[model samples]
Target: MASFQNINIETQIPEEILIAQIMQLHESISKLESLRPCKQVNSLFTRLVKLCTLPSSIDIEALPQEVKEMRDSLINLSGHAEGLLEFEFSTFISLTPEPFKNVTLFPYYGNYVKLAHMENKILKENGMVNAKKVAFVGSGPMPLTSIIMATHHMESTHFDNFDIDEKANEVARKIVASDAALEKRMKFVTQDIMEVRERLGQYDCIFLAALVGMNREAKVKILGHIRKYMKEGGILLVRSAKGSRAFLYPILEEPDMVNFEVLTIFHPTNDVINSVVLLRKPKA
Candidate 1:
């Protein structure tokens, strides 16, 4: 009955109980993929998510060396498990010669559907309902975001998906290869966003995936590349996390986008794990 409803956001979670719960969650999730369609992932995080919703009060800056090290290790394991789950599902779908027919069966496919609606709502509010060309950096092996957006939201827009892994791009390409409509609108590029040093001013919108930079330092570096190439006044959508969700995904901070004007910030209180940050590149 370790409950956090009465806990103050400013106070730390009981250290011993926190550590033990994390250990249990870690041990259980270690045997399973992080994002399984089963109840396993949800059951594991149900209680933890409650506590994590308001951010862990554990002050990483004030922690003892041993406690901090242990926390980092457990968090890394949790994050790695999540990445594996996405890869696992993507691999399964890729094996199906024509993945699009059954791609919606993806365990977390509904997440992207809701996410698409959220992004569309945001874009409409910002008067960017009809983007001509879009780029999704770190589109991953599945490319769910681009797939959902291209197929449903911006049906007329061209989507260019970028991934550093050639194999991932290959899989993503196959997912949309059978659909002539998608094939005509979506293109997968096997390249890192940082290497595309030329001014990427042609894109009307750009999306930065959660896994693009798993760490703060890496995220900062990638943002620099984006700022340099992103069209002046273009829109950039970033996926991030808040509170204990940081254990699975990197949290975006204001410092990361000092040059860009952040327009909106959203963190779903429901099962949706990602927080959305909308930003606009300032014209010099």
Candidate 2:
């Protein structure tokens, strides 16, 4: 009986073997998401940490060179996860800047760019506190992803989408209405934000994506509406392709706008500039 117990203990797995397995898992995740490689790899590594905690007999020091290589990949992937998210968001949103759609500079694409930046900024700043009742102004050419992410954060929220362009409004409406996550909470309206200022006060948060390059007068007018629509203690977020510091001058004076500001200026991810401005409303 003693001899059998000794044999069983000796046959147990080694820590080194477990580490090698972890490395392979990380590599597999990296391969899955070529664009979001780092995040995928990190996620795999996280899972490996859990697996390695098992009471195994593998020797940690016996890991092969290939396993070491995997460790290197994990480190590199973890280091760049944030940078990758930023780049992905920037390139996706402004695929088509103001002007002719076919222009090479303004390549029409999906809604990830705008949605990613806005969601990232708002979540990081507000920390998901009282994130209900969202209002989106100027739902742009593609705001499906933006509205979708917003619905995820807000609790039992209502989405009010306001847009002046009939075609743009239709596109956003179709996108929102089609999304099961947003359809229950979202409402789309084809109305100039300026004309609907009085009706906007009900929302707890407001999003303004790509309000740049419009006529200067129009920009100011829209800002006025945003100021009116945002609730006290709510949040107002803005994204722009130009990404300049001058973007916040128009609405800074609203007495209710929070003083702590978040300025996000990321390098062009694909071919588009990524700029974001986040302002929280005062609690009073």
Candidate 3:
């Protein structure tokens, strides 16, 4: 952790240098975790948090593996850090320049493409047609998933983009407005999921972004809330990373609190690790 602490957050460091620092810290942290006292572990967690809270202008692709490992460690060591990381990632995406804004940096493009394909496949398999109403929780600054769905489905689908970040909502609106087709079909809202609980049941499909809530408990609460409001027979598409990549974006397994029937599991055909779980609200 001390090796990572030497990084100058104020300056724009080269990607290679950052990666090297991250590797060193990762090795050291892994070796010392068992021997270090709780105080030392907490101190390392604090340093990692500072490293992760990089300026939004930095390219996420350039982010080193050490930073990702640190995130996983933080979640394992102190559950409270999940919220901090979520906010940090949201801020990083929100500050992305218009020209470079896509689903993510180029390395992650395949993930979104695979996600879009999985979404379409699930909708078709479930016999869902002309899904007129859709909602995306944690849509982020670009709302690329919603944009893709709208483009594929054309005028048949209308999307509501929700996020707690006002700045992200503003940017998402601009991204939508830039495309004439998307501008008419999408709406951005700056509010928590609980704030709009009353209207959830109206949507034919609801997308849960990988980083929607602060922690698993919060996520479970969100799942329970959605169960209460989602229309019977409606589809819930959850995006999650598989295995170790789950550190970056925690996976949402089937929660014990919800009674949703698993409709399908779509795996990525590309290098990306994310999979989409299509869940259906059973008719009671």
Candidate 4:
């Protein structure tokens, strides 16, 4: 047998470091195995990265200092997979929605809570059931959350639900129709938010859960139009899938006295999905 070059066992890492690296590798293997191919959604890669690399509350930058010795043994995980797109390369991925098995509103969560927590927070704070008016934009399945929350105490509030998607509008109508408490208080409409400027400021409070994707320019234009319907100090509730202070800053900087406040953040444990961001438009 050929004599092997003298190996320096002393240079080897400690056992704990080796174990941590192995654990991280196992996590990555599980994630890759669990990933399914789906084409309908745009954020698939970002979702995959989150699922593969992060825990619900992981601090991405600092590996537990205790485990740092094994750093070289593990892959350095990035926050989201889209980070890989800076280079001109393409990779394929897939996603599909399985039937959601467990559904209920609890302190932990259900789809409704994912959708409604923002509006509920505001209503509880303002004690605004007596307030004359309220509006909802994009009254999808989630608007029911707001309607149900409003029904709890508001006796004489006018609720308007608006949507441009026929499918969404139809679904909202059925949900609203079934609710006796909400029937007198709520109305559903199929219309674009931009086209309804004439009725702006007609409500004391407005709820917006519209999808304002990556297009910051469009959001700015829309906010400018929203100024018309809001009363001098009425509140505008906003929830979106995308949250960037930089994108929001331009609209908020407009000459109008309208102010923005963060209501609450309802981030889901599902990393492959976007967290919900809630905001308020202040009259001051």
Best by lDDT: 1
- TM-scores, each model vs. reference: 0.82, 0.47, 0.65, 0.50
The best candidate by TM-score is 1
lDDT of every model, 2 decimals: 0.76, 0.49, 0.64, 0.45
- On the 0 to 100 scale, the lDDT of residue 263 in model 2 is 38
Residue 214 displacement (Å), model 3: 3.9
lDDT of candidate 4 over 126-243, digit per residue (tens): 5444668778775643354455556544557788888776655554455455556666778777888888976867887676553431233566566657765567666665443321
Report model 2's TM-score to 2 decimal places.
Answer: 0.47
Query: How should the candidates be ordered by TM-score, best one leading?
Result: 1, 3, 4, 2
* Residue ranges of candidate 2 with Cα displaced over 4 Å: 1-118, 128-130, 151-156, 179-181, 212-217, 241-272
* Model 2 poorest ten-residue lDDT run: 243-252
- In each prediction, how many residue pairs overlap at the backbone (N, C-alpha, C within less than 3 A)? 0, 13, 0, 9
Candidate 3 has its poorest 10 consecutive residues by lDDT at: 78-87
Report the error of model 4 at residue 7, Å: 33
- Which residue runs of candidate 4 sit more than 4 Å off their true CA positions? 1-111, 123-129, 153-156, 210-214, 240-284
On residues 164-273, what C-alpha lDDT tens digit does candidate 2 reach at each position?
66665554455444446556777778876767766667766677755431433455556655665667666667654321111111122223233434433333333233
